[model samples]
Target chain A: MTLLTSAVAAIVCTIIWYKNAPKNDMKIGILCWMYWGATIMWFVDAIFEYAELKAEYFSPAPADMLNDFFLGLSVVVFGLIIWLVILLIKDPKGVIKSALSKKAN
Target chain B: MACFLISTAEAVVTTVAAKQIEKNENLREVNVSEVKYSHKTPFSKKLKWLRNMLWGGSALLLFEHVWHGEIVPFFPFLTAASNPADAAEMLHEMATVGVTMALLVTGVWGVIVGITTAMEKKAEKEDAAQIAEHAEN
Candidate 1:
């Protein structure tokens, strides 16, 4: 489920990015990269987990699946936090910079 | 809240930027009404991408959880002790694998954007030079 969750996310984000790709918005592209990166990480994770669990992987206990779901959500939220930091630094629209300059006056 | 204060400050600044762009760009600016809050600069598309990623990732995760019955109202996962299968070990994994994944993603993204932006600027310079040469000829 964890692997699949990240994979699904990567697909969705990729589709959105591609649809408006002509705009090639740097911020959005970065986001697409972030999710694709995560999908890779989770893919490796799932592979190793499958090797260990084999057919057992087909039927995880309900409790374990729930726990994995929460962990997946946690990662998503963490990604958002990181993206926010990037945005702050980039100040793409010069919003934060403009705000700072205004205060100096 | 600190977030609210920061947002307000951002709004004030963006409004000023929008006015400047309006004067200079001849209103070629997109999201004019939102100029004061979050106008689309050359890099703003990435911000849109980020928003979509968060929503899409979140929705997919939720859908998977629901399908697996791991997130049913009947099962209360809020209680950690009730689900020992995902606590200590998961925490360990989160700290190790989770943190590493986040850092790796961020680092890779930073490098990619840096390289691409440089390449883009270089191409633009070449194009301008070609135009000038043609005009001179």
Candidate 2:
């Protein structure tokens, strides 16, 4: 479930990154990298867990699935937060820079 | 059980290395007078890409382990560490899954750096061609 979530996030972010490839202002590529990296990690984790659980890996408890879903969502949120911080620091679009200058005036 | 720790440890080491490299690069820049090219991103910045990916993935995985009670806040830290059987299993997972994940991420990062470096090279070539054309005119 975590792998699925990260894969979805990676796909969505990759699309965004592709669309904005020319402008490159959003730095969406970083988000894509982060999500895809996580997806790969979770994929390996799932494989190991499945090796241990065997047939039972398919039948996760409902509560466990729910918890995993929440975990996945929170991971996405955290990735976005990190991206936001990078954007603010880099200010690729100069949005923060302009805002700060405006405030100074 | 604690497979993600491998990547987390690598991230910590790389993060410190990146900082040190950046500091050294800054000092080098101050001591040298060199023509600056616009498209060349620093190596330290590129290293940050790996750091960010590893750190982000490790953090999420750590949180997941904690949520699942595989990790504890107490002494041993890892619940598996307190048990002999589970400790062996945990070490096996670390050797296989953990090491694989870290290697895969680093490999992917290598590809990314290669692509970006190629792109920068192409851009530099184009700039040189334009300059030569202007000189000819």
Best candidate, DockQ-wise?
2
DockQ of each: 0.09, 0.53
Q: Tens digit of lDDT per residue, candidate 2, span A37-85?
A: 7988998888878898999999999998988889899888888998898
Q: Report the poorest 10 consecutive residues by lDDT, candidate 1 chain A.
A: A37-46
| lDDT of every predicted structure (CA atoms) | 0.55, 0.89
How many angstroms is residue A50 displaced in model 1 relative to the true structure, after the best TM-score fit?
1.5
In the predicted model 2, the residue pairs found to clash are none
**Candidate 1 residue-wise lDDT, B7-84, digit = tens:** 223334544664565555555454365554222235443333333333333443334445454455554532322556
Error of 2 at A96 (Å): 9.9
For candidate 2, the share of real interface contacts preserved is 0.52
Candidate 2: Cα lDDT at B29: 90
In the range A43-90, model 1's lDDT, one tens digit per residue, is: 545655778899998899999988887766666666566667777898
C-alpha lDDT of residue A59 in model 1: 94
